[model samples]
Target: MNKLSCILLTLLAWLQYSLWLGKNGIYDFINIYNTTKLYENINDITQMRFRNNQLLYEIYDLLHGYEAVEERSRYNLGMIKIDETFYQIKL
Candidate 1:
């Protein structure tokens, strides 16, 4: 009876170990979950980098292009060129 009980306990322990920590086990599931999170973070960083690049290009255009500067000046500061006649139409 004692030997039978000991053998059964050993088998149970081995079975539990194989189920939870073996080749295809709970550890694998956790690793897959972590990997999915890493992929999502990488994608988010890539999107942010793309947005940053677009903003930088816009800044460069505003600094170097006369049309962009003129548009901003006309819209924000109500600026007119020296050669242009200023007209104020009253609503």
Candidate 2:
């Protein structure tokens, strides 16, 4: 039964190949998982850069823009200019 044995061996080899290299196999799963993780990391870096740019702009505004300084002083430090009268309304 040498031919029968050869057929069974070929079938086993094909099954092994299908198991490892077929669609939705372990290699594909790992590759997709790694790609997803890489994209997630890239997105995280992009978001961090966006936040950094926003902070840099805010710093620039606070340093050079009088309106920003005035707003921050009024809201955060409870400050008013000498010529401006402070009025408080109770809610």
Candidate 3:
């Protein structure tokens, strides 16, 4: 009877260990969830970096190029070249 009780306790301990530290353990699930969140944050930062690069390129062009300035002036001030004619087609 004593041996049987000892074997039963040992088996219960092994089962508890397997439940907590096996392939699909709670700790493994938590680690995977944390890694997923970190990757999502990295993706968001990459997108923001791309947007910032595009805006920087636009700023550089506007600062250094006559075409950019001409476009801005044409749109903002209704400007035209000396030999150009203006026609307003209103809807």
lDDT of each: 0.92, 0.92, 0.91
The alpha-carbon deviation from the true structure for residue 82 of candidate 2, after best TM-score superposition, in angstroms, is 0.6
Q: lDDT score, residue 67, model 2?
A: 97
**Candidate 3 TM-score, true structure as reference:** 0.52
- The 10-residue segment with the lowest total lDDT in model 1: 40-49
Tens-digit lDDT track of model 3 for 1-91: 9999999999999888877787788778888999999999888988988999999999999989999999999999999899899999999
- The per-prediction CA RMSD against the true structure, in angstroms, equals 5.2, 5.0, 5.2
What stretches of model 3 exceed 4 Å from their correct place? Answer: 1-43
Residue range 1-91, candidate 1, lDDT tens digits: 9999999999999999988998888888899999999999888988988999999998999988989889988999999898999889999
Error in Å for residue 81 of model 2: 0.6
Query: Scored by Cα lDDT, where does model 3 land?
Result: 0.91
- Global fold similarity of model 2 (TM-score): 0.54
